[model samples]
Target chain A: MKKSILITGGARSGKSALAERLALSRSGRAVYIATAEARDDEMRDRIAQHRARRGAGWTDHEAPLDLVGTLDATDGDAPRLVDCLTLWLTNLMLSGADWRAAGTALAEALPRQTAPVVLVTNEVGSGIVPDNRLAREFRDAAGWLNQTIATACDEVYLSVAGCPLKVKPDDVSL
Target chain B: MKKSILITGGARSGKSALAERLALSRSGRAVYIATAEARDDEMRDRIAQHRARRGAGWTDHEAPLDLVGTLDATDGDAPRLVDCLTLWLTNLMLSGADWRAAGTALAEALPRQTAPVVLVTNEVGSGIVPDNRLAREFRDAAGWLNQTIATACDEVYLSVAGCPLKVKPDDVSL
Candidate 1:
């Protein structure tokens, strides 16, 4: 089992479910770290749905901004699964925090984790180029963040229609 | 080499380049089918850049709507690479055409083609839910279309940062 794993895909592509499966694969009692903020009804509903879907055998933690610190605090006995990175990036950008430096710090922190960590992220740049500058910038940042974490992780997979497709370690002869 | 290949990825994620390489691998010449319309300066510049990057040894055909007809017309002596399906879907939707039927027709048309068909598509549904209904619908359609065509293809590869990672007929142990 890899110490660090990054799972990325488009929305509803089964990333969280796959991450849950992987998180609990090694140990049944893994931590579910959420980065999303329930700022709206839709977001609140989404958070609730995720919590409901991810039932039992898990401890919940919300780290809308302090993800690295949260990981540090939860690195004891259970493997930690960060539900996402894009939301964390969004929070940082919205708050005018240094997302790039935070990304680097998170990558630097992953290698030193005493417990295994599985992070989830989205593939936001695959669509038509956004007509808005902010959307464009956010997508670019998300893409860069995904690649950075992917590069630093021990394993990387792209989930498609609920199936895990390994992207890192280049097993395919493509 | 598979007769049909679907290479999907994000914007600037190296999908076109990978498709170009696959298009030229078996034979030196291939048909470059363009689904994008140069509606604005941004689009015009993007089309021009794609043309410049995919230099010599290719015949170009512009089919913003009549993709199937064009594919049928040019399925001789060389492989056909549809630059993208999402744009074609957009054209279809904008023109009030039935995209679902079009997608089904496309899936059926792939196995029947005498020459190989390499299709490129975007992953649009992986990001945070769009604020607009139309964007949401478009992303859902794009995602469904990708999965539909991917299921029909002989091979599917996800280009991440310009490197082709085999996805369809997945060889990964994960």
Candidate 2:
């Protein structure tokens, strides 16, 4: 039962809610891994909203950078939900860490987990090309990251307007 | 039979390629309704690249604004492929036109089409929210448009790395 699922969508596309549902579906209790840091008021508000929605039946862990370590340590009977990989990448990028290597390591680490790991990410490359070079570079990296992680996962889905559309392990080829 | 399809994804996610395949899947020759206007060298180059990839059997039509009318005009023997809806929306917004009204009109016009129509659009809302107000507004409009068009379409797909995953007319809820 290696239920390694990657859920990706736009901002406010209901990815976290869906991930929460899947994480708690099999087991009433699950582990919540927060990759986001509340550095500002906006970030704090978002984090609070997510926390409020997730309510109970969840043990939370803050793993902004050391996601692999968090996953390895949390390996047990309870399923783990990484609310996002994008923020983890952002943290790595901002800290001058090798994000490519980090992303690869996470993909490599997915298969060995004893507990179900439901990861979430954002789709940032589909819009018009950004005017700034950094935004362009970030979007490019995000797209590549999504493709790499998707290749390693057991299942992948793209959420739209709060609806999940399974993409990987699907019959249709792109 | 009416076969209106909406194809959406991020940049270089293989949206246009998938739209072309679907457009020609039923008819050997299909009308290419491009909403893009070659106002500059970059845009011209991109348009040329698309044209080169499409190769033969495509009758090109430029309707940067009047897409609903273009669809009606091209409803004859060949199926029509609107290379994008996002660009059309951009044109409308830039011109200070009521894009919401136009988007709704396009959706309403889809059901009355006698010929098959394959509309391509971008998924712009999946990324980090833009820092600028205009980009934010555009992404919001694009997301609303995608959902609206999808509601009217017989099929809706999200392209990923050159693969097509059907989202509409499927049993998978959400």
Give Cα-based local distance difference scores for all models: 0.87, 0.87
TM-score per candidate: 0.61, 0.61
When summed lDDT is taken over every stretch of 10 residues in candidate 2 chain B, the lowest stretch is: B160-169
Q: Candidate 2, which CAPRI tier?
A: incorrect
Candidate 2 accuracy as lDDT: 0.87
Over B104-124, each residue of candidate 2 has an lDDT whose tens digit, in order, gives 999999998888999999888
lDDT per residue for candidate 2 within A16-125, as digits (tens), equals 99999999998789999999999999999999999999999999999999999999999998989998988988998999999999999998999899889999998778
Question: Against the native chain B, what TM-score does each candidate's chain B reach?
Answer: 0.96, 0.96
- Candidate 2, position B100, lDDT: 95
Off by over 4 Å in 2: B1-8, B12-157, B160-163, B167-174
Q: Number of the top candidate by DockQ?
A: 2
Lowest summed-lDDT stretch of 10 residues in model 1 chain A? A165-174
Q: For each candidate, C-alpha RMSD in Å?
A: 6.4, 6.4
Error of 1 at B131 (Å): 3.0
